[model samples]
Target chain A: MEILLAIVIGAAFGAVLDRIGASNPTVIGKMLNLTSLKLMKTILLAIGTGSILMFGGQMLGLVDVGHMSVKTAYVGVFIGGLLLGAGWAVAGFCPGTGLVAAASGRKDALFFIAGGLLGAAAYMASFPWVESTGALQGVLGGKVTIGAVPGSGYDGLFSALPGDIAGLVMGAAFVVIAFALPERLNPRGERLARAH
Target chain B: MTLSWKSGGVLLGVVFFLAVLLVKPIGVSTQFVIFDGILWNAVDSAVVTQTAEGVTSSNAYLAKSDGKYAKAVANPLNYSFVFVIAMMLGAAVSVWARGGLDRAERTMPALWRANFGDGAGKRYLAAFIGGFVVLYGARLAGGCTSGHMMSGMMQTSISGYIFALGAFAAAIPTAMMLYKEG
Candidate 1:
């Protein structure tokens, strides 16, 4: 039963990823180049909306904080994040989007997937050595929230600010930004030429 | 109607909401880890036994006490594994419906050609290296952008917020240096 639901949801998620041009390396590269804001807008809005729904639900007692998985802060996570970003810029596909691209019949994306699997395997093989390095050691034991909302399963800097309120403000800001940005700019378009 | 970024973003948010309500939060990397476990278990049963014994490294899905691990060891068809397969199937269907299967198969995209020259081998190598590094880094970090940034941020986690800032801070500059227009 859960597998069936996953299939349905996964299908919708994959379709949305493709529809947003995430499966296209050109589109992804453009976003990375800062030549386009379309993908950024989409990501910001999605995260913003999700933040609102999640925190808002928590506030209303509709969502269970216990169920949501929270990642912990670590020195390694910060360094790893930078590396992941560089990889995204170079490869033009994150793990999820790479799957979508391969599914879309991109043979190159298949190579990327293979590489990713190998990478995962490598990490597992070196688990002992890597763990010994203290990179995966969590500073807060894996539960820390930005706002430190009381009763929420997180602790962080902004304890006074309600998490739901923070989410609302962030969501509103993202929505406004999404609205303000144009979808695309044509090189021949007068507005683009005038800016140059 | 063609799904624009605006509509797609809205739909993604809705799907995320429903996913949280119905199941656990959406994550993709753990599915890969689960794959790694299954592969290692098949190639060398000792690896599986060691993981189960907590002698090597502990994985939630490979632990003997975990029901999912039991089901997976019995037959590699746990929920996360199935979800990964379903995600691929979904993308296939979407591409087929949208008539994008052929066009999406290009080996050398314009961006790669512009930045790295038109060598297909070099481009593929770069892709492979990038893939390896990203996945390894994600494992080191305990999650990827989706697992940490999107889901964690939704939960108002400080780690997610910091990860996001770190990612963009590095990604943008790296991209600019590599692909800056002359």
Candidate 2:
């Protein structure tokens, strides 16, 4: 029943992504631009609200801290990041956002999703070689989260910092960006609103 | 001026949250799973059954420690991944409702025209390459940009931090090249 509810919630979430133009790759892609900070407001708002909900839930014990997950460090990720970012710049889409784009009637988005699926399939088909190449054998480890460490670390440790601190930092960063950015530029998912 | 009924930003956040609360918290790398699932389904017929250690009766897969892998295949109705699928569906519905569901000609950057040849082929090709890169990175960094920049940061994962660093670093060059002055 809960999972079913989750699906409903998930569907609603997707609907929102479509309405806001988040599913549109270009709209979301600009967030990564250094000069643009195009996504700063959306980023800040998400981080801010996300922080509040997450911490509030955890603080109230409505959530379990232990169940959260992260991955082991690997060079594959580094290489992938470069490729993914480059792709975003070129094509203006990510997996999730791409899905939304396709949903929103962008045939171009459909192409991206299909392409990703094909690429993924191709990788899997070649996995035996990719794996045997030890291409991804950098540091094999179990699922680990930031809180798992006794001491703080990574991304200024502030970004990696969880709960209120991270929220405050991300939120503050957004606040600064909000002040720093122009209102005329429009927010990330509001592309259509900004367009005409 | 007018907000559409499809509101995507809050939904992005909402799905991001549901991801953690339900199935696998944080990252989902839809391309990876679909791609991997297809392969595993083909190869051992046991890959999909392969469950994470210490988990029992998970809706995704169950690890028995009995060496049989998990008991079930991942459902399309769970969180994160499902959220992504739902997102696609939502977008489809929204676009249809808005009457913006038709193909249109794009005439923006020269790069768009040169690469896509002012046709559907270039656009789709670009998308395909984009997906490939993202999944590869997700598999490599142990997460996607979403997992890293979005969920990873939220969860405070070291890998997420490291993954994000790579994403940002790479993003600099890519953005400069693509979005550079006309």
Candidate 3:
């Protein structure tokens, strides 16, 4: 039953990814290069709105804080993020969007997926050696939130600003930026138009 | 109406909210780890058992009761795996509906071609290397862009914000250096 629901949700999510031109490497590259803000605007709006719904629901006691899965802060995560960013810029696809791109029949995406799976497998295989290196150590295990809520198993980043208020402010800021950002067509698009 | 970036973003946000409301946070990186577990389980159940018990180098974190890896190993048809497969199905369906099937090809885009040249072998090699590095980093960090950045930021986790900052800090510079203006 849960799996079925997941499928439906995943399908909708995939469709949204595709519709936003996330399946196109050209679009992704342009966004990364700051040549266009279309994808960035969409991403900001999505994150902002999601933040409001989640934190807002928690504040109202309508959502169970226990249901949320929060990750720990660690030095490894920060460093890994740098590597992931580099990979994303070079490959033009993240893990999730790569799957969607492959599904959309992009052969390059299939290669990317293959590479990702192999990479994951390699990581697993080398787990023993890697774990011993202490690279994955130094974790701050407790949950950290921007504001406080009763029975929430997390710490607030700021004592003065409540989590809900902070979330609301950030969410609203993103929405405003999304609205203000103007989309520019990439040079590739202009070149294609000229050819046509 | 056809989906635009703005509307699509709104819809994605709503779907993400619904996902959190109905189940848990949405992420795709851990699904790969689960796949790794399944593969190990197939080759040698003992290795998986050892790994789960922290007897091996493989991380025991995912084998926790609430972990996605645990769910996947318990049942190959788990929620994360199904979600990923459905993502592909949804994309295929959308492409078919839009008559884009015929347009699908194994080729690099103009931007990539302009920068990296039009060699299929070289493109695939780059793709493969990039994919490997990204997944490796995601596993090491215990999350990917979706898991750490999107889902994390929504929940107001400081790590999420930091990860996003780090990602953009590296990604923007890398893109600027690699990007060739056409």
Best-first order by lDDT: 3, 1, 2
Q: TM-score of model 1, chain A?
A: 0.84
Output the number of the lDDT-best candidate.
3
What value does the lDDT take at residue B112 in candidate 3?
87
List per-model TM-scores for chain B: 0.82, 0.62, 0.84
Screening candidate 1 with a backbone cut-off below 3 angstroms (N, C-alpha, C), the clashing residue pairs are A145-A155
User: Which of the predicted structures, 1 or 3, would earn the higher DockQ when compared with the native?
Assistant: 3
| Candidate 3 i-RMS | 1.9
Name the weakest run of 10 consecutive residues (lDDT summed) in model 3 chain B.
B50-59
Q: Local distance difference test, per candidate? A: 0.72, 0.54, 0.77
What does candidate 1's lDDT look like per residue over A1-196, in tens digits?
8888888887887878888887777677777767776787887778777777776787888877666666778877787788788888888878888888888877678777778888876776676777688876777545677566656566655667775677667767767777787764433223433665
Candidates 1 and 2, the one with greater lDDT: 1
CAPRI class assigned to model 1: medium
**DockQ, candidate 3, vs. native dimer:** 0.64
In model 3, the clashing pairs are: A128-B57, A147-A163
Best by DockQ: 3
Minimum summed lDDT over a 10-residue window in model 1 chain B is located at B53-62
Q: Which lDDT value does model 1 have at A93?
A: 79
